[model samples]
Each structure stands twice: as C-alpha cells, then as structure tokens.
Target: MIFLDGIPISKWGLQIQQEHDHPAVPELRRKAMIIPGMDGEWDFGSESGPKPFNFPLGFIEYDKNEKQRRINEFVAFLLDPYGRPREMKLSFDYEQDKYYRVKIANGFTPRRIHGFAFFDLPLIASKPRKNFMVPSDEIVMESDIPILSDLLWDTGFSDRKITSPQSFEIINNGTVVILFSFQMEGSGDNVSFSANGKTMTFKNFANKSLEITDNYVVKVNGISDLTISNGIFLELLPGTNQITVSGSNLNLTISESLTYQYV
Candidate 1:
C-alpha cells in the first residue's frame, strides 16, 4: 500500500503471474529478443526505416528454488524533459537455469516511456486537509425524543475551551451526523465526555470532586444532546483527541454532565 499524505491508494493490485514449465528453453534462447516498445514488431533494421530503440543491456541470476516465487523487480528512473527522476517499477519472473540477457543494439529511447508526450502539464502544488464533516440532514437520532441540538446540524468543536464530543452512532439509512449538547451554565462544576466507560476531564472546566479549578469550563445545565447527521464530527478530548465518523451514518456523543439524566 502506497501512502500519500496519510491516505492510501486502494486501486492498485498485483498484475503479473509466473509461467510453469515450457519446452522451448533452447529455441527461446536463440529467438528471444526484447520486443520494441513493450509489445510491437521487432525492427531488425529492415527496409521499413531506422531500427527501434532498445533498453540498456543487463542480466541477473537467481536460485532455482526461488525462481517461480521471486519476480525480477526493475525500478526505472525515467528522466523527465528537464532530466529529473520519475520513479516506476516493473516486475516479472524468469526460469533460473536459463541464460537471460538483453542487448541494447540501440540506446534507451525516451519516447518508449508509456504516456510520454512532448507537451504535458507540470505538477500542481496543494495542501491536503482532513474532510470529516458530513451534511446535517442525513443524521438520525436513536433517542425516543431528540432535542434541537440533537437535530442534524453542522457543528465543529475544538480541544481548547470547548471539548469535542465523544462516540456517535450512525442512523437514518447511514447518513452522517453527531449528537451532543452542553448546558450554558451550572454543574457539579465539571464538564467532560465519556469514551468506553472512561471519563476524560476537559481542562477548561472546574471540578469540585477532584478539587481542580479551571476558568474556561462552561457549566452545563440539564440534559444536552447534539447530533451530526451527514458530515464529519471531530473530537478534542484531552489525551484522547480523535475524530469518529462513518459514511452515511449517525454519530452520538453524551456529555458527562448529563449522564445521570439519561441513566
């Protein structure tokens, strides 16, 4: 798997397969010649015109036991128009006992490169960002009576003053959304979120139980719930900050301040 900017390319897969025993071992040696341009006519300097270009000549040997399983990996550093290296790999396996060699009869031809063109667009530079937000209308609430904040809404919270919500459940035919709510004031003086039975403290709030004091914490009153129905939901939980979401699903997060009300 090739990772580019934390994302992976999922479209590529193994293409070549090895061949078993064949009897043309002798005739192949005498007739074998690198076909010009991958697969085309062998220009043996016929009256047709000038001969086709060939690759640099080389040969490699491998153990007979490792013949069928090991492919000869060829990494070509194709020079661009400005003579910069563009990496690409080609792979295939051959019989071990056989004498395999390539004769360049001609120099390497830049035109032989696949997709090679005289005029091509230069590479573009851009920054990559995480797209976790889904549309709000697609979220579904699992609770019997969903509140306003619990309704589908485009919401984003940071790990700073306002701690992001916890786990969310997908609902409404797999539409994306999150459920979260916090009271504007009042509390045991602590605001936090729960994940897998563990409660993480939000440094911005004050907690009398732990004798910890913080001014940025917002005291939440009553049960507050928020739902993200369609887009991405990001969490800024202390020490466990992460983003949880699913394609076309419902996400739910319950604040610690409202745990007793829901229970």
Candidate 2:
C-alpha cells in the first residue's frame, strides 16, 4: 500500500499490483576529470541526485461506471487546480515511520488493459532522502535549573532542570551528518553554544530570542540577523554530539528531528 500526503491511494480505487521500485539508493552527483598525464580521473567529490520511485497502479472498481470518476479523482489529488504537480509526502506500508518528499515525475495517463485501467505513477524526490514521518521531538532546557556548582551545594530542583551551563548529548541514529537548529532566550550578560568543536557566543543581549536555523541562518527572534558569523549552525554526526550551552538565566530549545541521507 502507498500513501500520498497522508491519504492512501487505495481510497481512490487505485491499487499496486505485485511489485515496485525500492528507490532506497539515490543517484550520485560526482565531478571528476581525467588529465592527459594522469592515469586515473581526479576525484573531486560527489553529492546525491534526485531519487525516483515508480508504482504500477491498477484501478479496480466493482462497477465499471465508477472507474473514470475514480481515476479523475486520483489525478486531481496528484495535481493542483493549476495543472501542476505539488510536493507531497510519500510513504509505504513496510516503512510507515518514514516518508519521502516527492512530486509526480511527469503527467500520467491510464491505459485500459485486461479489463482494468492501469498506469505507471512516477514520483521524484528532489531531496533524494526519506525522513521521519512523525513530528519533531522538541527538547527544551529551561533557566530555572540549578547551576553546575549546585552539584556540590545539593540544591537540585524537583523539575527536570539540570544546571546553568547546560551540557547534553544528542545521538543521531542515522548514517549521515544532519543539521539541527536551536532557539534560546534569556536576559543575560553572555550566552555561548558549543557543538562539534564550534562555538558561538552572544554577549550583552537582553530580552531577545536568538535562533540558529538548520541552514546556518541566524536570527534574532523571527527576523534574520546577518551579524552572526557563518558556520555557527549546529550539526550532529552519525553517532553522538556533545552540546554545551553556557549562560545566565537562559532557556534553550533544540529540535531533535533526525534525517537519514543514506542507508
């Protein structure tokens, strides 16, 4: 079974026959050149290309009269009113927890064969990756926590707060490095975030929320702030990433969504 944008195609009288393309691996986008004096090609690097998935769908309606209507509905769902393909969430029965961001590769037309209407549904994922289908698990760190010195003072709170300079570890179960974002707010003298050997410090800021986007864009609250240095965006490797945040009376929220770029 296949689901598009949380709606099953079977609802529109469409059903996959026997098999479909696995589409687990994406094509590599590698740049290489062979020099006249070199015996092998020079290796630059490679990125991922779009991934394609094809579904051989057959329309089966008990009443022959309803077949055309159902087919039209199916097409309407895949295309917008402007007759253009839209991005959709595509998932399968076997891996319900993951989904692909996809669009129709090309226009589809059903051909009548063996008393059934059949068509090839081609989907192309521009991201060339499958992501977790569920909502992001938000990890929030509040300022009410005891400071690190409290460990000796024996003044830990009843809540989940740990310390003033919060230190934590985030594990990326995926096989590739993935970018993450965080938002922090506090009235303080200085605040610093460290991860993956990179540190970003904001000093003398008050009553403003600082955000670092997954794309490495920094913003004061919702508006983009260009003053932040590049490469301050946080990232998690395949295994564990040690994250340290130091500030006075600050609250931080980190998004824990993980994306698997490869197997």
Candidate 3:
C-alpha cells in the first residue's frame, strides 16, 4: 500500500514491481559524485544536492468499471498543472516510520489489462533524496531552559534563573546536511554557541533579535549582517549532537526546529 501525504492511495490494492512481470519492487536509490574540485568533476565530491527519486515501475490494477474513478482520483491527488508533480509523503515501510518525499518525475499512463487497467508512476525526490523520519513532523520543544539571566520571561520571574547549559540533542538519522534555523533575543559582551564540535561567537552585541539559518544571511534585529565573523550556520549530522550556548553576561531563550531526513 502507498500513502500520499499520509493518505493511503492504494485502497484498490497496487503492486510495486520491477518490470511487467518481475514481481519485485526495484530498489529506490540516490546517486551523486564528489565536490570541491571547486573546478569541476573528477575529485573528492560530497553528496550532491537533493536528487530525484526514480521509483521502479508500479502497477495499479483497478476494476474495469471503476477505471474512470481511479484514474481521476490518482491524477487529481498527485499531479498539478503542466505535468508538474506535487510533493507527497509516501508510506511503504510503515514499520520503520519513514516516508519518502517525492513527486511524479515524468508522467504516468494507464494501459488496459486483462479485463482491468494498470498504470506506472515513478517519483522524483522533491527536495532531498532522503526518507524523512516519521511521525513525519517531529519537533523538540524546550521550556525553562536554564540561563545565566532570566531577562525575558513571565512578569516578576527574572530573579529565578540559573547558569546551566542550554543544551539539546538533534536526532537526525540522515547522512546529509540538515539545515537548522536558530533565532534568539538577548544581550551580552560576547555570545558563543557550540554544536557538535564547532563553535561560533559574536562580540559586542546587545539588545538584539538575532536570526540565523543555513541557507540565508544572518539578520540582527531585522538587519542583515553579512560581515559578522564567526557566524557559522551549523548543520546537524546523524545521531545525537551536543549543543551548548554561553556568553559573558548573556541571558536569552533560544528556539530551534530541524527537519530529520535519512538515505
């Protein structure tokens, strides 16, 4: 069975196969070659950007009388305009709690079968070529994270603060770079953050709302600061990562959200 964006589309019972009669679903794969020749080709390259997922051909056999309904539903739910595919969360390996984010790459056509009908739809990995870990959307919500100062909090709760580590674990199972978004409002002489084994520091900052992401420029109080040295947008690796934030006379609250993916 296959689920599209958490909805099972194979109520009619579909069979994923290698070929017309191979009776096996071809393995879904992602392929890429080196990076940092900085020039081009033939060197130590990393996993290229998110690649497309080419699903092995699959057959969806439906009752002859219900052919029209099945075709309409599949097309309506999966395809957008101009043959462009829509991103869908497909669930095939339910036991592992993983879903592939994909869209139709080429197109699908139904061929008449023995008194029935069938079609083939291969998918393109929408963003990343990794299978997203489920519940699908997992979040880490931390409240009461101890801080050196409790400047921002409930009224009259400023004096009840401690100087404990602002640490959390990022549970990313994918072998790819996971973009992380970090935003916080605070002030200090020097603000420092340590993730995994990398650290970033900001000096002479006060009363500012700082936002940082792996894909864009760092913004301080609504102003983009491209010259901020030691401003490293940290990417999370596979497994549990140790993250800590510290600074002299710094009191702040940090909110972070990272989407998990796996190959």
Candidate 4:
C-alpha cells in the first residue's frame, strides 16, 4: 500500500496452490503513482500497519540563463531591506526507494559593499642614505689653506657629510653624459672643493676659465657658449682631457658627492 497526496493505494498480491486439483499463478513488479507535495504514509499489510516514507524533492531541470537570473534576483532581494518576496516553502518528492527535499527561504536585509582601486601608479621611492666625497688630490696646509690635485676623486669617499645632489651618469655608445647640479659662488672663476684630507678650497684657472657676470653663465672647454643658472648642469662628451673650466670669477659649492663605475 502507498499514500500520495493523502490518498491510499495498494499493490496487487498473488497466491498459488499447485497439486492434482490446484491452479498456478504468476507474480509481477509493483507500480505506484507519486503525487507531488504528498506527505509520505503507506501500508503493506495488517502486521506491517501504517509505515512512514520519504519523498524526493529537488530541481531536476532548469534553463541555464533563467536559473542564474532567478538566483541573482533572490540574492539582490536578500541584500535589499525594503524588497518584497512572493513565496518561500519546502518542496519534496520521491524516486525509486529514495526521498529528497529542498528547503528554500529568503528575506530582505540591509547590506553595503565598498572597495578601492588605483590608477597610474608610480615607481616606489627609495630611502635616502649617506653620500661621501673624496678629493682627487692629497691636502697639505699652507697658511691654513688647502689645495687639491688635478685628478678627479671618487665622491663616495665622503659619505654622510652633507645632503647629496641629484645626479645621473649614463653612456650612449661611446659617449658618456654625466648630469649633475652644483651651487656657484659670486666669483665664477673658481669653485669650492671639499674632499678627504683637504679643507674646502677655492680652485682657480688661468687659460680654461668660467666667468659669471650679473647673469648666471657657464663655459665648457674654454668656450663661453653656455649660460647657466644659480646651479650648474654639465653634459660632457667622452675623453679624460676633453673639457676644462677656467676663469678668475668662477666658484662652486658642492653639498654632497656620489660615485659610479662601469664594468
């Protein structure tokens, strides 16, 4: 016996008594109709009495886009506090001997979403470190004055002495360009030189010289073609003795120093 939608149905049974005066009977598989939304209850025999059974209930088929749309709608309704819903209940059914059920409930609630986005990010800045200055020549005091050699020295030799100037050294093919800035004194012929073992000195030049009048100006390789501001910027071509600055009024004040090497 089986119950579906509150209706009772019974499975047909067979019996046989075979002998000289008896007949034979055949048995067949049982079939029952499962009504949707039925509370499971059935009876097989008097001794078995009323037995409780389960019904299988689930979404067996759906259109893909429609299913997704429905799910999204439900989610949106749940996130909105003032949204209204039509229905909410449990669905069940049965297949073979197994039973399945699906409980679905939804309501509205308040929720807010927030996040961040970035655009056109720049390169990270590195922390400032100590910069050293090294003089090209050894210093010997004469009347409390110091002198430097003609050769150039590594600026890294004097680290943590002062604030470093912004500079960059690059090579394109065989040409080398060193871009740097340095403060100039009123007398533009000589520049201040402070290095290891040397007191800051005023370097002077006779033939190759630079002169600063009322207007800031710069000279490279004895040519007065370049005019500079309060700070001097130089772009020199490759070659050790290629360029020189000489003048009576030329002077420079270096705040910091840096060093670079090529392999």
Question: Highest lDDT: which candidate?
Answer: 2
**Model 2, 38-123: lDDT tens per residue?**
89999999988999888999976556667778887887888888989989999877776567889999877888755589889999
What is candidate 1's lDDT per residue for 104-195, written digit by digit as tens?
12222211223221111111111111112122222324432224222223133322122333344322211222223232221222244443
Which residue pairs in candidate 2 have backbone atoms (N, alpha carbon, C) closer than 3 angstroms, thus clashing? Answer: none
CA shift at 236, candidate 2, in angstroms?
A: 0.4
List residue ranges in candidate 4 displaced over 4 A: 1-153, 156-176, 189-233, 236-243, 249-263
Q: Using TM-score, rank the candidates from best to worst.
A: 2, 3, 4, 1
Give stretches of model 1 more than 4 Å off. Answer: 1-188, 203-263
Q: How close is candidate 3 to the true structure, as a TM-score?
A: 0.61
Better of 1 and 4 by TM-score: 4
**What TM-score does candidate 1 get on C-alpha atoms?**
0.17
lDDT: worst 10-residue window of model 3: 149-158
**Candidate 2 whole-model C-alpha lDDT, 0 to 1:** 0.68
Q: Note the clash tally of each candidate.
A: 35, 0, 3, 24
Off by over 4 Å in 3: 12-43, 49-65, 81-83, 94-96, 126-128, 131-177, 201-231
Whose TM-score is higher: candidate 2's or candidate 3's?
Answer: 2
Per-model CA lDDT versus the true structure: 0.24, 0.68, 0.56, 0.26
Best TM-score goes to which candidate?
Answer: 2
